[model samples]
Target: MQLPILAYGHDILRKQCDEIDPSYPGLDKLIDNMWETMYGANGCGLAAPQVNVPVRLFVVDSKSTHDRMDEVIREDHFVREDTGIVETFINANILDESDDAWIDEEGCLSIPALTERVKRPWSITIEYFNRQFEKQTKTFYGTTARMIQHEYDHTEGVLYLDYLKPLTRKLLHGKLEKIAKGQIKAKYPMQFVK
Candidate 1:
């Protein structure tokens, strides 16, 4: 089933997510729904908060991103050899982030049409549980790392727009207001705060 994505201004989007254990009911089903919702929205990543669930879970399919690598490389100089990785992260924590920062324009399924250039570390070491609740610690770099970081932020009550410069944010105030008022249109189904 494809869950309705909660739009910006939803209270849940600003709340920190709770960690779920292996015994959590319907864990597999939720993950599957998230994947369906994400792919339905044509998003590369989706977090529980986006679905109005305050849980530390997210899904990422970098295949679409991989498919766009040629254009990305031409426009942003992003160089990476690995491609097409799909993974689920639960109860994730960033152990460390590289000092090297990169600026990339990012968009969120919850925020609809808004996109912003945010600066984030190029690499990160993270500890997380897989779908089976197995613990795994790994390092990710390039586009994959960027995608993970974005989704991780959602779990911590952070949005990509928060990283924009004050002036830029101010400039986008009108659009942001429209989004908050549920006046904007998104290709996918969304639930806005009343």
Candidate 2:
């Protein structure tokens, strides 16, 4: 089932998410629903907070981005030789970040009609539990790493806009306000601030 993604200005989007163990109820179903919601929204990733759940869980499917490189212009510019990963991350933590960085335009399901150029490390090492509760630590590079960092920020109550310059953010203030006022329309179901 696809869930309604919480839009910008939702208080939950600013709160840190809590870690959940395997004992958490409906873990499997929630993960499934998140995937469905993400695909429906045409997003590469979706975090728990985006769905109004304050949990340290997110799903990233860089594979889809990789697959679209043929038709999408410059889509593979930052993607590495690796095909990319499609996996779940629960209670995830970024352990290390490479010195190299790259800039790219990023958009979020929660923040519709907006895309910002953001700079992020080219590679990262993260540790997290998979959906089956198995502990795993892996390093990712290129587009996949950027995708992970974006979703990881949601777990820490941070948004991509926060990385923008003050002037840029100020310029976008009105646009962000419009989204907060529920004046934005998205292809996917969204719950706005009310």
Candidate 3:
């Protein structure tokens, strides 16, 4: 089932998520539903917090932008999944170590109807888990890496707005307030912020 996405000002989005335990009932289903919910909402990533569930679980897909898997191989680095979807990270550690820069427009599910430009590292290495509860690590650079960083931040109670410039926040403050007040409805209300 696609869960109702919580909007801005909701406390759940700001709360740090708990680690996922594989033994938990409905864990697999939750992951499936998260992806369904994410894809349905036109989002590339979705954290458990967005669904009002504070679990250290999130989904990510970043294949088109970052093709730097070769670099990690060159460094004799460890490899994980062929398809990049960091399903559940009990504790995710992200390292920013890439020079290739790119500025990208980003949107959030909580702060619906607002797309802001945020500066992010083009590449990163993330250590996390797969659906089967196995440990894994991978390096990504470009848009894919940005997606991972964005979603991981959600697990820590960080919002994209926190990273936005003051001017950007000021411009969207009124609309975001309206969104919070339900005074205006976004034509495309986001269900996943990352």
Candidate 1: residue 194 lDDT (0-100):
79
Q: Residues 1-194, candidate 2: write the lDDT tens digits.
A: 99999999999999999999999999999999999999999899999999999999999998888777774543544444668789999999999999999898899999999999999998999999998899999998888999999999999999999999999999999999899888988998999898
Better of 2 and 3 by lDDT: 2
Of candidate 1, the 10-residue stretch with the lowest lDDT total is 74-83
Better of 1 and 2 by lDDT: 2
Best-to-worst lDDT order: 2, 1, 3
TM-scores for all candidates?
A: 0.94, 0.95, 0.80
lDDT for model 1 comes to: 0.88
**Whole-model alpha-carbon lDDT for candidate 2:** 0.93
Best candidate according to lDDT: 2
Q: Itemize residue pairs with steric clashes in candidate 3.
A: 109-193, 122-142
Candidates ranked by TM-score, best first?
2, 1, 3
Q: Write model 1 residue lDDT over 4-107, tens digit each, in one string.
A: 99988888998999999999988889999999999999999999999988999999887677777677483343345556569999999999999999988899
List candidate 3 segments past 4 Å from native: 63-90, 99-101, 186-194
* lDDT (CA) per prediction: 0.88, 0.93, 0.71
